[model samples]
Target: MDKKDRFTEVVKTNQGLIFKVATLYTNNLQDKEDLYQEIVFQLWKSFDSFNEQSKLSTWMYRVAMNTAIYNLKSGKKQVNTIPIDLETERFAEVLDKTEEEKIKVLYEKIQMLNLLEKGIILLYLEGKNHQEIASIIGITISNVGTKISRIKDKLKSQIKTT
Candidate 1:
C-alpha cells in the first residue's frame, strides 16, 4: 500500500482507540472531538517511529492514551468545565441505557481513574492480554495484572457510588 493507503487503513482500524480515549478524557462533544483530533495528529506525527515491533492497534492505543494523559496533566483541558445545555443534559440523563449506556458509564468511571489506571483499564476493557498491555504502556506484565485488578475494584466502587 502507498503511504496514504497505509494511513487510511491505520485510521480505519483504530478509530475506536481515538474515540474511546477521547470519551474517557472529555465529557463534552466538542472536547471529545478536540481530543480525537489531537490524538490523530499525534498518531500521524509518530507514525514514522512505529517500527513494527508491536501490533498497530497497540501502538495506536499508546499514542492516543499518552496524548490524553499528557493533555490532562498539562492542564490543557478541564472535562468538568465543559458546558452542557439543559436539553442535552436531560436527554443524556433520561435516555434508556441499553448496553451502550452501561458502557458509557463505565467509560466515564474510567475517566475518574488516574492516568495509569485509566490506561490499564482501557487495555483490559479492550481485551488485550496483560503482556500486550504492559508492552504498550511500558510496564511489567505482573504490574499490568495488579493494576487491572485494582482498577476493576475501583471502578466497581465508583459505579456503586454514582
Candidate 2:
C-alpha cells in the first residue's frame, strides 16, 4: 500500500484512541473534534518515522496524547460555544454505564489533573505497561508507577465527593 493508504488504515483503526483521548481531555465538542483532527494530522506527519520498533497503537496513543496536550497548553482560542453533536452525546451515554461509569467519572476527575498526571493516567487506562507509559511520557518507570498510585487515590477521593 502507498503512504496514503497506510495512513488511512492507521487512522481508521486507531480512531477510538483519538476519540477517547479527546473526550477525556475536553468538555466541549468543538475542542474535542479539533484535538482529534490535530492528532490525526500529527500522526500522518510522523507516519514515515514509524519503524516496527513498537506497537502501532502504542505509538498512536503517544502521538495523540502529546498533540492534544500540547494544543491544550498552547492557549489557542477555540470556538466551543455550541452544544455537542449527536455522536458525542451518544458516546457520553454509552460510556456512562455502571461498569464504565466509574471510568467516566474518573475522566471527569482527570480534568483537575496537571498535564503530566493526565498523560500518565490515560496511558495506564489504555493498558500500557509502566515502562511503555514511561517511554511515552518521557518519565522514568518508577515515576509512572508513583504518579499512577497518586492519581488513583486522587480519583477515589474526587469521586467520593461527587
Candidate 3:
C-alpha cells in the first residue's frame, strides 16, 4: 500500500488509542477534539519516517502520547467537566457497579497527576509492559517500574484523602 493509504489504515485501526490519549490529557470537549486532530497530523507528518523497529501501535501510542502531553502543556485546563461520552457509557454498561465506581475514582485521581506521571500511569493502566512504557515515555525500563510503583502509591494516598 502507499504511504497515505497505509497511514490511513493504521490510524483507522488505532483511533481509539488517539481518543483515549486525547481524553486523558484534555479537560474539555473542544480541547479533546483539537488534540485528536493535532495527534493525527503529527502522525502523518512523521508517518513515512517511521521504521518498523517497534510495534506500529506502540509507535502510534508514543506519537499520540507525546502530542497529547504537548497539548496539555500548551492548553489551559478548563474548570468545567465533560459529560461521559457514549463510548464510556457503553464501557460502563457491561461492568458491575463496583468496577464502574472504581474506574471513575481512578480516573479522577489520575487528573491530579503531573504530565509524566499521567503518561506512565495511563500506559500502565492500558496494560503496557514496562519495556513498552519505557519506549513510549523514553525512559529506562526499570524506571518505568519504579515510576509505576510510585504512581500507585500516590494514587493510594489520593484515594485515602478523597
List residue ranges in candidate 2 displaced over 4 A. 73-86, 92-104, 159-162
Candidate numbers, best lDDT first, in rank order: 3, 2, 1
Clashing pairs in 3: none
TM-score-best of 1 and 2 = 2
Q: State TM-scores per candidate.
A: 0.78, 0.81, 0.81
Ranking by TM-score: 2, 3, 1
lDDT of 3 by residue, 9-111 (tens): 9998888888888888877767876788788889999987788886897888888988886776767655444343434566668999999898777777888
Candidate with the larger lDDT of 2 and 3? 3
Better of 1 and 2 by lDDT: 2
Better of 1 and 3 by lDDT: 3
- Choose the strongest candidate by lDDT: 3
Query: How accurate locally, in lDDT, is each candidate?
Result: 0.76, 0.79, 0.82
Q: What is candidate 3's local distance difference test score?
A: 0.82
User: Residues 1-162, candidate 1, lDDT per residue (tens digit)?
Assistant: 887689879897877667778878776767666677778878889888987966888888888888887776544554444343323354466566695577676666766888788778778888999988989889999988788888778867876887
